[model samples]
Target: MIRRILISCGIAFVTLVANAAPDDSIKVVKGQVSDYYITVTHERIVKGRVLDKNHQPLEGATVMFFASPMHSTTARDGSFAIKGADNDIHLYVYYPGKKIVNKILALDENNLDIVMEDEAHKATAVRRPAQATRWYDPQAPLSRTFCNPVNISYNFEPFNNNVRPNGSFRSSADPMAVEYKGEYFLFSTNQGGFHYSKNLVDWEFVPASFQRKPTDDDQCAPAAYVSGDTLFYTGSTYEGLAVWYSTHPKTGRFKRAIEKNVLPSWDPCLFLDDDGRLYLYYGSSNEYPLKAVELDRNDFYPVSKIHDVMMLRPEEHGWERFGMNNDDEVTLRPFTEGAYMTKHNGKYYFQYGAPGTEFKVYADGVYVSDSPLGPFTYQKHNPMSYKPGGYVQGSGHGGTFCDVKGNYWHVSTCMLSLKYKFERRIGLYPVAFDGDGVMYSSSAFGDYPNWAEPMDIKKPADRFTGWMLLSYQKPVEVSSIDSIYTAANLTDESMRTYWAARSGNPGEWAQVDLGAVKTVRAIQLNFYDHKATQHNRAMDIYHQYRVYASEDGKSWTLVVDKSDSDKDCPHDYIELSEPLRTRYLKYENVHMPTGHVAMSGFRVFGNGDGDAPQTVKGLTVKRDKKDRRSAFISWQPDTDAYGYNIYYGIAPDKMYNAITVLGQTEYDFRGLDADTEYYFTIEALNENGRSPLCKTLKY
Candidate 1:
């Protein structure tokens, strides 16, 4: 039956058979179809209209209909409908906001009209999801499905402030992002203070007085090298492959001269040879093979004495070991850590991050060479294509920068989930090069682009590389505010449907416009948690969140909270304090304001008065079991509805419930004991009744 339904839909069974007749004015039958067929099918009804490079019609445009048994999808107007007996087909059209269409169908036809063209949203500009804005029509006929591997969106800075890699410091690969002049430093080794970005989606934290720690405790090999005023680094200490020197290379201040095992075999890299010598590649990985020394053109150090070179592994070349057969256990068993070498134009690529490290369909690889050390050559289409969120499972220690207009970039670091503990994160991709220099990784970059590289307003100090002009950030004036602060009206959608009608919410809370400040400090609540919200608050509202600082926006102050209340909040951030100077600020709503409150955007650096915002009402709790120690609460008649609260606790207690739970979900008490501890809380009832108090959980 069509090769047993393409082997039970894992698809991929090519064998098309030929036929003549059934043709009554439509001919397109080109053979190949076996594996016991006898079903008399007669498919072929493709239609299409996925457009953007100005062609129009692209409503969810995702059509696919590869032939060889079958595979289909295409609706929302870009219609499709395959049946399959075999008449010829091969159409894969995916329009993730535009662009991605491959066709070559020849099925006797009924009415075909495909036209898809979105060349990467015309170079990056497609950020739509407020229900996708509408409009689709440029002559329709679209329908087909089964092909989606293009949802790529770039602009990364997913925080990997490492140092949390535990037990003898397990492992945390490299991240090395650099933009120098205009800002974007990122350097990684899992974490050691250093994340500054001017706009790669806002990143901050360069404290530890700008960190460069040369010892006093070392691990370092998250590599950083600056060139021009010299600032090269390497780390793996007890004092070993150490190497640190900074004539203020971008100014983080360094000076740890150990020179002796310059490559104590870690992740150091520093090439700058065009006759000036300074090659230092290191590696105890990529199956141990990457070594080089040569340095010293006046204190670049290590003048030669490292050796090793070559051995990035994998490639007996012959069906590259046939998919190497993944009976599927997610498969992964080949190694080779990060190896870096780049040379553009004179050609010498050689990137790495391969085989094992939590396999995601065999990780990254690239190779080519003219000489950085020798004999590179892989890339007959090496393992380059498997990026489930570029940061999935310990990506390899990667590095490659080039942006003075030579435009080549690649910074890797993966592990946002690889099952085996340690959630490593950090990603940035976009490296093209193929004229034999080999390097291709374009996860769709047709629009909405910005990974830094476009701020040379006539050399604004070359974007201030290694930055050092720090001055402009002072401006917080909301009409000399003394404080009348009520705040919390968030552009009202009935107060976000009244806090999304509570229960496990995702709505309500609006009072933002903090565009003038003098001293209100922190407040960032761009919250969102409704993947099935409903656990009664405080698991740190789905793991972690706390950044409350208010000067009258309604009595509050918790300032940048994160005593690790469990862990799992991440959605990017910027809640500040220690540098206040505000006009007013508000965004108090620590995790899960109820259950599923969604807010995709909200900024308030200080200053308000945009008016309207001050309602706050959502509480309804009920529980009655009086005597085990307490229980007997009643509620359910909210005038303008806002009166009823209760929260209980006990079980790995940190402190769960303490009064503040009125208008009944039932609550009464008197030391009983089978277990002993218990907790519950709630409060908010007004228009002349109950207020003040809120808590939830206990069992």
Candidate 2:
């Protein structure tokens, strides 16, 4: 006999199983059973994972068992489970705005995997109803600044719904960012254009003024560096990878000189050492090591033999291996590209991005050498730039620069692309050098909007200010919404899906209810460019909106007013000068870049749950003889922690030195004296406060 059970969200169900032992991981419980050989509930169960077409886990997906009301959600790993009461049970996997996935299990089947198709894959004429679940895009279209791809003329999809793999909204890979005259500028290989940001928070698209004819090769991975007052640029091929220069970066035009062969290069950058010497670093591909050669001072061309700095070694480094989990074993070797170098405190730090441009784990790693041309050693904490879990993903192929405040910041690629393997977006992270001279980029809340000011102090203990997520899955109301483009999407936390007004008319608004009154610290009004047509910077004023907060659902008060603000911030983050308490929040749209009144997140961040993180524990330190300059430190992470601080030195009592590892539990101690006895401890920090130090360790 088979029994069918049903349960909904937050509901519980009990099932009988004559299992050898109950599995608590999925809440498999047992009930009355027969004796030994005649156990009434003979062990039988079905469990598996829900994945997208790309084989990536679909977290937070809702799974329902057919006929049996019992079901479990897909975990971060995408696994779901249900009691197997019969030989045939249909399982349905659903994500908001995505196509529904169904699978059936027959007898003798213990594992069933389901892959969900994106509604985008289906034609608009045959689309399903809106399930406004996710807050971000799935493919992660890499088109922030110059979404336009170079070879856009040769595409299959003339009309793509996602707009990511399509024209203008295409790949903008290798965001070579630099600070020039107090403004941040990004050049990429995708569109052969550039982007400029006055505050590192709002990037505006600018056309490639230098290249009149948009030849795909000329714009690929353009390199720029300030030589005295002139900015030198090169990359992509034309007769000889010609050198271009312009005193004004924002002007977007470069004066191209018809010089000759500067050594066939890929992913290249010109680095100026403090001593007035010029060196060139370039190469990208598993076939070649990231090589460096000295550039002549007079003409800025390669003057010496190239030195192979480093190569891809996925066989040893798991992070450099390709695949969603970096465990896929196949024919082709991994890729190593995006070479960048920075000199700090007389030490040369060479950074490289790797493992192909398509992987989620794609990141930037580092190597250290005393000389510009080096026998460089890989830093134990490789992939120094990483943020795989954020709304936007990859952080590889980026540029490191010092802000006007003398603080270090890394601007790397984020978001994603599907039309092309290199489809990507740009992201900024707070970075710092420790007492040991090791450098790290803090990715805590990386995709979240942050302060535009350069932090001159040591990198923040926590990149995120411990702001609790106050409106996740909360009740939402919109003045007007398009069919299926519901209001609840305003607080889903992913940027892929959003709430859209019935039309792009002024006055359309979306509001969120936080359930109860709560203290709000700041609000991130992330507007979306939903299938927007104008790819280039427009003549119209920057996107505009106004925010209001209320104690009850009725009366409202102005909390943040940007109705007249002139800034092109699709991901706009507005920090209130002070914290305010309110149960209801609303956003009124004044105007937008395009016809849709779309919004990804009307996020409310504040201290709703009052409490600091618990103290860190399980501290461990390891010293390896292979590399004498670094120590690897790790500890159990605190769920509530905004970040972790690792303190260490030559003596336990005198361990005054420290480094704050943001959004991660493990940290590599670089610049340490390998032979000296070193002691270390750790502490967890949140917006409220810090926890006590954990047990110390010596090496």
Candidate 3:
């Protein structure tokens, strides 16, 4: 049987006051009986005074009524009055210096008095999933001092600050740092070379034991595993994997034991089993498939036994993917890269990097299995993090480690300096597990249990305030409907609009000449694929169409009604119709409506005379001398019309026979061959109508 238990704040205080005079008796008014009511009641004359921690009355305290729809504010005397009805009500009292009070009460007595205290918990101390972690010392003075600068795109950036006096190479990603005997040693890999560090942070260049080998200088990512005095590291030298062993790790020199050239791999990591066998698990990228090989404790090479772990394949999961086939264009499709394994509480946590380990998809996730080699289950609430704008892009290369306190932490590289576009900085975050032992990234030091913050509701007009257009989905042509329109509202103007006209023909841009209107501030183009329209797909699923406006119709500005949108865009058309105003507004364009096409419902708003425009006639058309099949044409725009139009014909006598009207000043006709003669002419159209044809010339 499944049961849902509700936890309630059990603290309550009741206050009732009785005055001597009859006139002072509590006044109760029977308000209009309705389904909804506020916490404060009229007849009860619920008046109250609130004080702060020091017992001083707080001015401008916001007393909120939850579950109910009504609330009132404290006046100069820290007093408020409310007309409430009997209901399950929770009062949330808030002020600048006082702690927030959430009180649940059933109305009985008339008079109410309350006092609030200073909250010990500060707002800034609130832990978030993206911020929770031991590495993030919220109270630490040096919390924001460091920066992350690493490019996870190529998936290879060395860590550790181990530096040499010559300053040959940089290494701040020191994951395999251990102190043997009296000296400390660090291991790092970037691109295809190896580096080491005496200290954990500072790093120095070292001769790569596998670099000088007789190959084309291509090396795969590396992972180091140290047990007792024997140091083991995996290296990919051009072909397959080559395991290197070294006793003099401090000297950074190693000797190869066995090189297996079969499976394609990178970022090879070594793990030891209870039976004393070594397991090699590595992959191409966090998005690629990961393979595993069993190494004999005797030789550290493949003992003729191999295993492959299917952690993740981009196509299997619903997340974004990248890297394409044949061509070099990067897609949102998945390509696995970083793969690390950790054992905790009898469970093996297999982590994989995905999408963009930074900028776009700046988070990491983990899978768990009871046995180290069995099938694993992926965490549901993954993306494990929400990284806002920061230097923490591609932050998923380092491994997870346990601190001295037995707490878990994750250290990875964050691309801090994009200057190289390839190098990145290393950073650390804390990892916490739920009751089920699922690894998750934390934005704070502790796990948040059953806590959810209320989202603030915003008005439509209020939403577009101070908005700016930083970028568009793609560059657009004047014809295709899918264009992006954006705006920046600096003046805070509430209402602005533009006008449009429905072309008599469907699926056409009906020209609306804003007659004599010089400047246009705002515009709106009505897209009616509604029930009355013919288009069904657009009407059924809802897509956007194109609508543009201009200062001078001749130099028109493009506006898209709906182009860029996630499946769950917070603001949709339903919200727009609910009384919204804005200074700058653009119609985002989308594909043509599915079932219906629009030809009517043209509208115009803003400060302008909505009327017909004048037409211009004088224009010229000429065929290209090089390729007679091509034609070049120019036309004079009408001053009153704010734009012009043009047409052409293949026969000289039928100059205006075949016409293709254009908006801009020039038009280029393609697909013509050399030494061919073509005849063309021009005409101007506006709100008034199409004008007479002008000069026609042949090449």
- Specify the highest-TM-score model's number: 2
Which lDDT tens digits does candidate 2 get at residues 1-699?
A: 323232445454755445435422233223422212222344457788888889999898888767766667889999987675554467677886579877666777778788888785554343332221122111231122111111111111112343434443324567676778777767776443577766554456655643333233336677878867787777755246677778875667777654654577778877988888988888878787888999887776677887999997665565677664354558567788888999999899999987767765678888999999998998765567865543456677888888788878776766455334554556667677777777777664565434444434555434455565676678998988777778887877555567878777768888899888887766677665555555432345366666777898789877655555555556565555556878998888876767588876777777664577787888888776685545677889788775676766555654544555556788654434444566788878654556788877888
* CA lDDT scores, all candidates in order: 0.41, 0.66, 0.41
lDDT of residue 653 for candidate 1: 29
lDDT of 2 at 562: 55
User: Candidate 2 — worst ten consecutive residues by lDDT sum?
Assistant: 146-155
Candidate 2 TM-score over all chains jointly: 0.64
Task: Write the residue-wise lDDT of candidate 1 on 227-343 in tens digits.
Answer: 665556665432455456665444456666665553455666666766556676666453356666776746556766666655543333211111212122233324455567777
Query: Candidate 3 overall Cα lDDT vs. reference?
Result: 0.41
Worst 10 residues of 3 by lDDT: 445-454
On a 0 to 100 scale, what is the lDDT of residue 278 in model 2? 87
- Runs in model 2 deviating more than 4 A are 1-171, 181-184, 189-208, 211-218, 257-261, 418-421, 448-455, 460-466, 479-488, 536-538, 613-699
